[model samples]
Target chain A: MNRMILYKEWLKTRWFLLAAFLVLAAGTFYMGLSLSKTVQFNGADKLWEVLVSKETVLLETLKYLPLAVGGLLAVVQFFPETARKRLKLTLHLPYPQGRMMAMMYGYGLAALTILFLLQATVLTVSLRHYFVTELVVRIMVTAAVWYLAGYAAYIWVAAVCLEPTWRMRVVVIVLLAALVRLLFLSGVPESYNGILPWLVLYVLCGQVLIFHSVARFKEGLQD
Target chain B: MKKIGKIFIGLSLALLVLWLVPWVYRIVTLESYSTPFTLYSCVVHDFTSLDRSDARNFRFIDRKGNVYGDEVQPLFYHSILASKGAFPDSLEGIPVTEEMVEHNSVILSAEPKEFNVKKAPVYLLMESVPVRLELHDPEDAFVVRKNGLAVYRMADNTLLEEKTGRFNAALSAEGFRFPANLVAGKPSHHKEYDEGYLLTDAEGKLFHLKQVDGEPVVRHFPAADSLDLRQILITEFTNRATLGYLVDRDNRLHMLRPDGTVIPTEVRYDPAREDLLVVGDLFYYTVKTSDADGEHFFALRSDDFSLVDRMDRPYDFEEEVNLCKYVFPCRLSFTSSDDGWVKPRFSDFSWIGLVVDLLVAVFIIAWRWRRKNTNN
Candidate 1:
């Protein structure tokens, strides 16, 4: 459960991390180099020109690197081998199985946090050469917000994938994501007055699902 | 299995219908381009040669091709015609003078004199009829071009020339009658007329042609609307090999070609080598010049007149040109160099940039996956 042990384990996989960072860095660098000559870099402060200008929003969307990385992290967390290891460890561990799983989820969150910090440091250092004063804060804030979104995804993945019923958890996770997005767009805003209670009901169901997964994990260890 | 699957299928169908319904309704109810406009008069400036750097020193050419440097006022007097075919009876009086105390609205009555002084009082008739024109009161002057071709109302109700020996005086339109009360006059010299008469097409193509055979003829392409350009100065017209020339109104010079093309003097002078620039909804392209030693210039689209990129500039243009917003009174042109071409440089990142992204993506995935596996 030690945070230090989790950090050391993540550090051991530095080679793989280096490769992923290279892919993102190359793409971002290409963008910066291409944009340096255009109005996007030079005319960022011109309100009308920037707002109506082409490629302005496209360049802004590139800053959502963290969210992409987080989705991939979710897939990796759900790998079958990891599920087997968790089940085996719970049987022998003296601590309660649910507590152990919670600790693992915390460990996954810490890894994502470190990845975000690394990305922030790299982006800041690279932007220094451009010397564009107006866009520095916007770019930094964009990176931070997207990284936070990635962390939220990590939390959802950790809670779902540790359950004994892996296939069921996957189906539920996808359906829930889809439903929330739909309800947020249609049910809530279409003057559907009954949507609030339904939303609360959905949240309650989510809580019960997590409680059921924890109970199943403890029972699986006992069996 | 049967009931749950059927429910899922129904839900999917409902969602698809919900999404497509709005789009279908939008297509059915959408109206095509329809913008309404009321007829009004605005005194536009007549420019001969604009230096962009100086407004006061702009050399204004007259209809007779003589250039003069002086300050001319723009007076806009415009109102909706009360009746379409009826001659305007409002302008059926002698122009206000010092002796006419009743006619003088605010200023005291002065001596009735010919328009011979340095700054002459001039007026513009927006929509002209044979008898009456939408005349602006004498007090409301100088929003339109003051030192150019002007039509004012005379006491006799017949349109007369305020200046002697200019050009065709007997020219008339068959369907449209000359408003009787309107009188045509010039400010001081023929060069002042060159500063006023200008033509802008539906595609934002601006042309200021010199009045040859009395008035500059405006022939709109495809369905050409032949409007006699009241005041304009044609500086250069090369029809042989290159069908392009620069025309001036007061001081503003616009570069135009025969094939429905207009490149504003401002865009030809932009510092950045952008592929395109937008003015209102219309787009103007930035491109290199055709001649061996020409610089980067702009060319508008022939059909619908969107921007089309030409080439880059050979020389490094000044940065001050970027501040122009059509509000500033300056001589502007988007010029390009045909001699040399420079490719856009992209050197913001090295090998490190690639390494960073890959590392970051891999690290997050590997770390999270490992944690998930070990915990389970």
Candidate 2:
């Protein structure tokens, strides 16, 4: 039954996932090309000097890509189910309702983790050619927060869509906005290093919020 | 499940209200003010200020509230005064020239944020005695690792084994340990000269490393081994009387001299919290340290680090009534004025505001109850 639910989620999101992967690949390719062009023009020493002295990550253009993909993935996966009231039918199945909801959320989260890993792998492989291990790690560590923000966005958006009433959805959104703002508070590379563990815990705690909205929907709290 | 959801949502709402409301209040009540530029004048023998507090009228005033109109220009702006043929012959009974003032003048500023931020371990070691008499960026950079120092050729990102071996041997001969705690240097070629880097080894021993020509000049200070050194800044001022400044674990400031002598200064400075600015001339060094409360000024004799004078100026806020204390239970901020790192910081809890918060809760419940009764 869990396998069937996971398959259903995959079927719903396969095309959107493909598009997101392609878009992310294109962005990574563009960044690589731009970095190569700079190295060719000014030599790699100048690039290294700038990276050492300046507060730039060089992967800034791709910062918001993960966020957009995460938010949109949530919309693609959940909006139709809620809009057509198909979730009510799904919840009425013989399977335990709590396990069913967990399976659905777990599917979405697992898919996002795999997708984000691929993006990070591509970045790591390309960055290694031009930068030292320390420099490469600095860029990756800085980009880690954005990827976490993506996960947080996906979870929060799912909760918002699953919410039963309009007033409560607005409240969830305001809270989510403030929470998201916390993830992007600093542009200084690796400035999030000290607080990253707590932020990860915060994102993990947010997973329960989706269950909150589902519980509301089960209570028939409609607007 | 329903009860947990309600509790979670309630807690989130409370956290948001506590964080955002005070933030919004601060933003809405923001005001603009500038600290007057203060400098101690050797000729006037008092602190002078350029007060542009009023946007329209600018005043140059001495500590005694005496305005000198434009006559004070020569005291601070010696170059401009010399260009206009108004430069004084002597200051404080000592004959002065434009070259003397220009060479002797040094402004050293150290902010807490600069020390707080993360820095790459790589360092550029410029040749102290360049062939063309002007400094140029070195072809390689070095990193201090647990094993020893590793030098990398910057052009192709390759290791320079020969140079690295030479430096490692030089440092080892001086009894320097592997893995430096702090490395400070003025790396830019725009400076008058390069002082290489001031490093504290793993055991808190001070070692000065510089490249004269193509070899390493390593000097280890055994005297610094007893002190718990926190930070060292290499200053390459044209005067060359002092090598750099050092901050010990107790937050006391010391001046590093050319003869390898560390002299404690009378200036009280906290390098991790306050901003320290030192404006030095031929006669005196005016050190200013500023924090949230106010700015503290110390004038020290140039020869001996004796305190010549001291003054304090408290900051004034435009808002007469601070609503933050009465309206906000606590405040949340991600960034701080003291450091460049972005991390969550919750501060300034007002126990007085809890009463207000309780009253607000009662009022909200009463209003909701009254509305429900009317509807029924």
Candidate 3:
């Protein structure tokens, strides 16, 4: 049953996920190419100066792409089921409905995690070829927040989509926007180091709000 | 289980309200505010002001609204009193020489933006004894391990064991402990000359360490005890008359003279919270520490480092519009100035906001309950 559910989740999100992967890979490659060109034009020593002494992480293009991908993932996965009332039938299936719902989320999250990790690894490995350890660490730390922004957007979008009623959805949208805004407030390298733990907790806890959506859909509460 | 989900939704809404209420109130109440560019004039022993918007148009006005500058500009330079006057022949009662202005005028600034930014904990210990101060590029950076035990050169990512031993031995012989707490220096090549890093070891003892000709030159400043030192500022003054400012735990400012003597001065600064800017001229060193409240200006004698005058002003924003006091008595904020991280900060709270939130929650629940019964 879990296999079937996972397959259904993949079947629903494969096209969108492929496009997301391509967009992310292209963005990462552009960041690498741009950085290599800078080193080529300015020399490796000057590139070291800007990275170590100054605050240009050279990866600003990757900032909001992950966010859009996350949002679109949630909408694509669940909106069809909700519109066709297929989700209602799934809820009535002969299984613990919670497990079935979680299986669907689990598959989507696994795909996203792999996509984001690959994006990070490619950028970091390429950065290390020219930059030394200290410079590479700073660049990766600065870029980490944007990747986390993707995760936060993904869960928040799920919370919005799962919600059954218009009144609650409106409130969820406002809250999600504010919550995501926190991820991009500061661009200073390593600035996110301390709050990152709490941010992870917030994102995880925010994901729990989707359970509220599931409960509402089961209760058939609509405005 | 379903009730837990409902509670979570309520909690999320409450958190959003906590952040948004104060921000919205601030947006509605925020005003455009400007304060005069204030400087402490040594002649009058009070704060002198120039309109921040119009530097040329503003007269040197005293706290008493007594306007003076036409005569003073000439004294500093016959040209400013003339038009192109650079340095005056004399000040109120003392002779003003071109040499004094050249040596005395220096500026230093400290803000959260500077210290709050994450440091790599790597420094280039340039050869301080060299006649020419050639700065090091980022490629030559090195990390000084706990108590100078090891110095790892970042260029080749190699440890210089023998050199590190000799440097650490010199420091260890001079009552230094292992693992330095604060190592302060300006390693950028853009400076006129490099001043060696000032480090306080684990025991809080101060030592001066710099790399010279591939050898570590360790000098100890016998002036300060380590336990009380809060932060170090290396001014690298051109005249080399003063080393920099040392902030004590009490936030009292002290002038570090070249002879390794710490001269306690009345530059009241909150080393942790406030941003400080020290501007030195021939006559006085104006130390300004600005914060959310406003700005505090302190003028010290350029030669003697005495408190000549002081002035304090509160920004009109806090004074003019304060609806948070009435509406959001207690608020939740996720950002802070004291540190670089953004986390949950609950501050300036009044119970009124909490009570209102409770009312909203009740209304939400009651409204939903009524709708369910009507549908049934």
Candidate 4:
């Protein structure tokens, strides 16, 4: 039954996952090309000096890409189910409803994790070619928060889609906007070093909100 | 499951309310005010400041509330006063010249955000004894590791094994340990000269490292070993009176001389939490340090570092009472004026605001009850 649920989620989001991967690959490729050009025009010494002295990681393009992919993937996977009222039938399947929902969310989470890891690996490989290990690690630590923001975006969008009432959906959206703002308050590299663990906890606890929306749907509640 | 979800949602909403309500209140009641720029005047033998409260015309006032027009300009604005041919021929029986004022005057500022940042552990060691008497950036950079220093040629990112071995041997001979605790230097060719880097080893022993004539010049200063050093700042002031400033664990400021002597100054400065400004002339050094509470001014004689005068200006509290404490139980901020790191900080909790919070809750409940009755 879990395989069937996972397969259904894959069938719904296969194209989107492919597009996200391609978009991420193109971004990484562009970053690599730009870095190579900089090293070619001005010697590697100047490039290293800029990286050490400046507050930039040269990965600003990837900042919002993960967030966009996560939000869009949630919409692609769940919007049709809610819009066509097919979620009610899915809830009535032979499997336990809680397990069913968990499997669906787990599949999405797994796919996103795999995609984000690939992106991180590409960044590490490319950055290491021109920078030392310490500098490369600094960039990775700075980019960690953006990837976490992606997961939070996915979960919040899922919660909004599953909500039965329009008023509550709007409320969830406002709260999600505020919450996402917290993840991007500072542009200084590694500024989130201290609060990253608590932010991860917040994202994990937020998974329960989707269950609340589904529970409302089960109660035959609608606006 | 529904109950748990509702509780989480309530908690998230409460966090937002606590963080954002006070933020909005402060923004709405924001006022524009700046601290006056105060400097000690040798002529008046007291502190003088420009009163800018009246934007149309600024008045120069002494500490004793005596206002002066334009005649006192030569005391502070020596260059401009000299250009106007109103320069003093002699003051306090010492002859004054524009060249002397230009050379002796120095301004040093230190802010918390500048020091409270994480930086990459790579340093550019400029050549101190350049071929043409002008400092030039070196082709190699060094990183201190647990074993020793490793020099990498920035052009190809390859190790300079011979140079690294030479410097490592010199450091070992001087009893320097690996894994430095703090490395401070002015790493720019724009400076008058290069002083290389001042480093504290793993055991907090201070060592001065510089490159002269393409070789290493390492000096160990054992006088600082007894002091628990927290930070060191290298200065290349035009006067060349001192090498740098050393901050000890007790928040005391010390002047480091090129001859390996450290003299304690009479200024109270905490580099981690305060902003420091030092304005020096030929005779006296006026140091200003500001923190959350207020600003402190210290005047020290330039020759012996003795305290001449001191003053304090506390921040105004009446400006903070404009509905902030009454509306916000606590303020939440991610960025701070004291540091550059972005982390959550909840401060200034007001028990009075809890009464307002309760009233808001009662109002919300009453409105909800009325709405339910109307629907019925």
Compute the TM-score of each model's chain A versus the native chain A and list the values: 0.60, 0.98, 0.96, 0.98
Q: Could you tell me how far off, in angstroms, the CA of residue B183 lies in candidate 2 after the best superposition? A: 1.3
Off by over 4 Å in 4: B53-59, B69-76, B322-324, B355-376
Residue-level lDDT of model 4, residues B17-77, one tens digit each, is 7788778877888887568888877777788788776545546688889986434545458
Stretches off by above 4 angstroms in model 1 are A1-16, A36-58, A61-64, A81-85, A96-99, A131-134, A166-172, A175-212, A219-223, B1-376
* Per-residue alpha-carbon lDDT of candidate 2 for residues B1-376, written as tens digits (9 for 90 to 100): 7677677778878877777887888788778766888877776777878877643555677889887543464545786677778898987788888888888888899899888888878787678999999988776788777878888877777888999999999999999988888999877888888889999888899999999888899999866777788888888899997888888988788888878888888777888899999988888888999998899999888887778888898898654565877976777788887886877677888887878888888999999999999999
Cα lDDT listed for each candidate:
0.35, 0.84, 0.74, 0.85
Candidate 1 local Cα displacement, residue B190, angstroms: 30
Over 4 Å off, model 3: A43-48, A51-56, A129-138, B51-56, B73-87, B92-95, B124-138, B144-176, B313-318, B336-339, B354-376
Q: What is the clash count for each candidate, in the order shown?
A: 93, 0, 16, 0
Instruction: Assess each model's interface with DockQ, reporting 2 decimals per model.
Output: 0.01, 0.63, 0.40, 0.64
Estimate the TM-score of every prediction.
Answer: 0.32, 0.94, 0.87, 0.94
Model 1: how far is B157 from its true place, Å?
64
Would you list the rank order by TM-score, best first? 2, 4, 3, 1
- Model 4, span A1-223: residue lDDT tens: 8789999999999999999999999998998899899889987888777777778888987899888888988888888879998899899999899999888888888989999999999999988887777778889999999999899999999999999999879878978898789888877778888889999999989899899999999998998
Compose the digit string of candidate 1's lDDT tens values, residues B262-356: 44443232111222222111112222222223344333332233344333334333333222222122221111122111111122233453465
Fraction of the reference Cα-Cα interface contacts (below 8 Å) that each candidate reproduces: 0.00, 0.57, 0.35, 0.61
The interface root-mean-square deviations, each candidate in sequence, come to 25.2, 1.8, 3.0, 1.6
* DockQ of candidate 1 against the true complex: 0.01
